[model samples]
Target: MGRTSDAGEKILAAGRSLFEARGYSALGVAEICKAAGVPKGSFYYFYASKEALALAVVDEHWADQRREWTRILSGVGKDGGDAGGAQPLDRLRKLFEETEAGQHAVQQGCGTVLGCLFGNLSLEMSNQTEAVRARLQEIFDAQVEMVAAVIGEARERGDVTVNDSREAARSVVAQLEGQVMFAKLYNNTGRLSPLWGNCLALLGARAA
Candidate 1:
């Protein structure tokens, strides 16, 4: 029982890594199982098809990322305590900073920026799979709402002047994805440096 569950997890981790590094269309189930160090039968045992595995990978990644995003954007500590009293805009800035740092770390590990898995798959596979397309839409919608909540708070506190918080938040999320795409294209994490400034502008913050 223990080994059975472990095999599924290994396949998931391998799929996520390969999908992020190579995009989805370029990979095959045999290749994924090889990377997972499991037999091809093990793949069939856990996933009905590659698309099903893709959905699993996306869900697992989002579950982890949503936790991190909540902790940072909501200013809640991992211990369920206050997270240093960061203001809304400041928490937003930290999100960008952490993004840059994360890409940099991935570059150092793999010698190239892998961009974002969700964004990469959205471009590469959204047209090919309706399931993946709908899932990606749902993910981005949640992200926009999270950022909009922050923007709404900032507006109430006079920290920003945005009229439509949701629209501004969509712009901010779009900007983040665009900048991450540029970072991957240029093979330079530095391309992400302007995200905070661009976000401030989107929010109509006085500092911007």
Candidate 2:
């Protein structure tokens, strides 16, 4: 039973890695099972189908990413203390920096820039599966809401001149995904460097 449970986690890890590397439509359950070192039966035991596994993978990835985003955008330290009272704009900049650093690290390890998983899956699967499409929409909506909350804080502090924080946040998220797509296309994480400047322009942020 213990080994059976471990196989489920292994399948999820392998599925996520393969999905990120190759996109969802290109992989098969047999391949995932082989990479996971688990029997094909184990996959059926844990997931109803590849789509189910994909949904699970998407949820798991978003959970991790949302946690990191929450931490960075909230200005909380890694050790659970205040991050030196970082202002909202500063926290937003740090989010971009951290994203760039993460992409760079992945490039260092894999010699290829795997862009945002959600963005990639959205492009590939959003049209093919309603389940994935709806899930992706929800994830993106949540992301926009999170950014809007930060933008609201910045507006309150007179740091930005945006009237509609949620709309501005949607643009910010779109800009981020577009830049990440360009980064992946050019195989250069440096493409992410302009995100902060673009975000500031979008927000009409006050001069520091």
Candidate 3:
């Protein structure tokens, strides 16, 4: 395959920012072009259509998010070493703390609670397009897998009592997205704590 063009990366980056700032329906092909500083022809050269680009953005954004997830939840320390030596519950707390910190940054920078990208797209386009909806479901499933892996590690160490790590992971992701949606509606990050608290209780991941 040919090397990825610089224009492709720029367009995807711009699309992510704009699509996150506004929903899919609100942004058009022309607007994406302008933000990306690329011509109409250039966009089609990389992506077949706006919808196609949206899928690519989801893939790209999730790749970046997953790396962070691995770093925090997987217990990889700054020097790329295993700090998984920490209790699963402790690692879970640190991961959620990091997630909260990131949301706080987005809230400050965007001047509003911009909820999870996957959640936003899931709500907006899940019923609109089968392919997009399928892609999103896959992303959510991958999220569950990631969380479940962490939970399994914790479980093996006797830190988490849950026998069904997959189910528990699903609940955690659902609650997270639900809290994010609430934050968006209330325009406050304060709602996250109680929701998170409930998850900690349910998963028995609370600190002593």
Best by TM-score: 2
Better of 1 and 2 by TM-score: 2
Ranking by lDDT: 2, 1, 3
Q: Which ten residues in a row have the lowest lDDT in candidate 1?
A: 1-10
**In candidate 2, where is summed lDDT lowest over 10 consecutive residues?**
1-10
TM-score rank order: 2, 1, 3
Candidate 3, run of 10 with poorest lDDT: 199-208
* Structural similarity to truth (TM-score) of each candidate: 0.94, 0.95, 0.88
Per-residue lDDT over 1-208 for candidate 2, one digit per residue giving the tens place of the 0 to 100 score? 3453589899999999999999998999999999999989879999999999999999999999999999999998668888764899988988898899999999999999999999999999999999999999999999999999999999999999989999999999999999999999999999999999999999999973
lDDT of 1 by residue, 9-99 (tens): 9999899999989999899999999999999988999999999999999999999888888888988765778867479998888788878
Candidate 2 CA-lDDT value: 0.94
What lDDT score belongs to each candidate, Candidate 1 first?
0.91, 0.94, 0.82
lDDT of 3 by residue, 1-208 (tens): 5544688887898899998878798999888988888887899998998999999999888998888887877677657888654666666666677777788899899898787888999999999888889989998998899888878887887776778999999998888898888978898888787765777666776242
**Model 3 C-alpha lDDT versus the unseen true structure:** 0.82
Q: How many clashes in each structure?
A: 0, 0, 0
Which parts of model 3 have CA positions greater than 4 angstroms off? 1-5, 77-85, 204-208
lDDT measured at residue 100 in model 2 versus the true structure, 0 to 100 = 96
TM accuracy, model 3:
0.88
Shift of residue 70 alpha carbon in model 2, Å: 0.7
